[model samples]
Target: MTVSTATGPLRPRVRFTGLARLSPRAGVVASASLIFILVMSLVLPAVTGYGPDQFVDLPYQAPSLAHPFGTDGFGRDVMVRTFAASRVDYLIPLLIVAISVIIGCVVGVAVTLIGGFAEWIMMRVTDAIIAFPFLILILALVVVFGQTVNVPFLPNGTIPIIVAVVLTGWAYYARLARSQTLSLREMDYITAARIMGYSTARIVFRHITPKVLGASVSYAIGDLIVVMGLIASLSLFGAGIAPPTAEWGQMMFEGRSVLDQYWWVTVFPLLFIIVSAVSLAAIAERLVARLEGRTQ
Candidate 1:
């Protein structure tokens, strides 16, 4: 199905009710915010009146027309790095959340299809994983892998964060899918399809999974922002993307000592992170509202 929105031209309706229509506003704002950041980040390498790492002004320059966000402790342009680091900072969380969601869908399907004692066992194991404080579990994983382990799939250090996120975050998706599947399996359409001799796999995969996907996807919108914030928090604590990288959390960490002196260094990056999070959260809220038929 397709859906239309209040902004721009009409688009296809996605069948979410009520408040889901508001998702367009959220989506547009989020997209605009990210795009603005991305454009700045991507162009930083090319269009530098001042380099992110190069000292251009006196230390702790206040915001001005020339240096809109002011200068940092090292006199590096705060605005430049904030824009430049946008891609690197956002990229990790985006990747982590995508990987986690994919893993969630796979695990969710498996848990539901297996049912019986197997389901119980799998869920308990998942519950254990879920019960861990997210920060503590992440810290433990970092210790096991060491602070800077290279990923087998990616040459960079990003793989570890992705792995950590997927491993820790799937339980919720699994439970959601399993619960939905349990109820769906007993529905008349599924029963009729089964009676007509559809293979168990076909009924489960084709009939049940598709219906649940809409709800799962809507849920995932919320989860994405949560994942972003979690990753940023980890970064602030020193387990996320490392230094010399333009990640918002790391930027905040780098600026702490000089914050009283170079407040803009910390403030701009933190502001970007907050804006991005709020935008995504808005989108998720709209999606939930629409799905629940409360969009009006």
Candidate 2:
């Protein structure tokens, strides 16, 4: 006679209730803000009917019926430029986040799965990159690369900024992914898969990647907010997108000298930047809560 044992349904070792819950009101507000920004970015350009660089009136003109945001130092329409710059402001951060996340995830997962020498090498390199001050690294890269590289579809001067931001940004995602993967690799399911003779590549791609991507995606949303500020700061300091491009940072930089007299020049762009960053950050927080299974 032989004895048999029964197995029960698997349960998680740790419940995420504390980490996952987010306020419903906050979620609603964040969603609404993001939607408003997205709509404004798409709609304002067409409705305004003023070219960003087009001179609508004399310089230093304050907000009025014709030029709602007033004219800048160069007589360009601040309202039009502000709206036009929305496209770049939104686009650059998004592209940077996407590129960085993808590269980081791939590298992180690969190093974790391969382990040993590869893991050591990638982590060291990532650490070294991270050790540098973020702003200085970006500025250095921008200076070395020069700010005029043009890609087929992107704006003429945006390539350098994109490159620098992506380079500096990916390390965070990589570290996040690696840490998540490390914990996930020891899970019962992963061990079961390994015991079942599944190939390493199949296990890594099919099982491991999904579990690790959740946190990375959430972090990327928050990272977008930081990247937006960085881009604006770069432009404000004379190393961002060039003139006539209508980027918010460049606009603020150009208007700084005349800020005392023509407040609209810098204020409007600064307002938009703040709104966009805060809205995106709120959304990211909600997403993190949701991803971690928090509910109120």
TM-score for candidate 2:
0.85
Tens-digit per-residue lDDT, 129-168, candidate 2: 6666666766776777676766766775677777777786
Clashes of 2: 2
RMSD of each: 7.5, 9.1
What is the Cα-based TM-score of model 1? Answer: 0.80
Model number with the top TM-score: 2
Instruction: Give the alpha carbon lDDT tens digit for every residue of 69-185 in model 1.
Output: 988777778888888776766666667656655566556666566668877787777767666666676677777776566554332445556676777766666666676677777
**Clashes in model 2: which pairs?**
20-294, 21-294
Candidate 2 wrongly placed segments (more than 4 Å): 1-23
Cα distance off (Å), candidate 2, residue 280: 1.3
**Deviation in Å, model 1, residue 284 alpha carbon:** 1.1
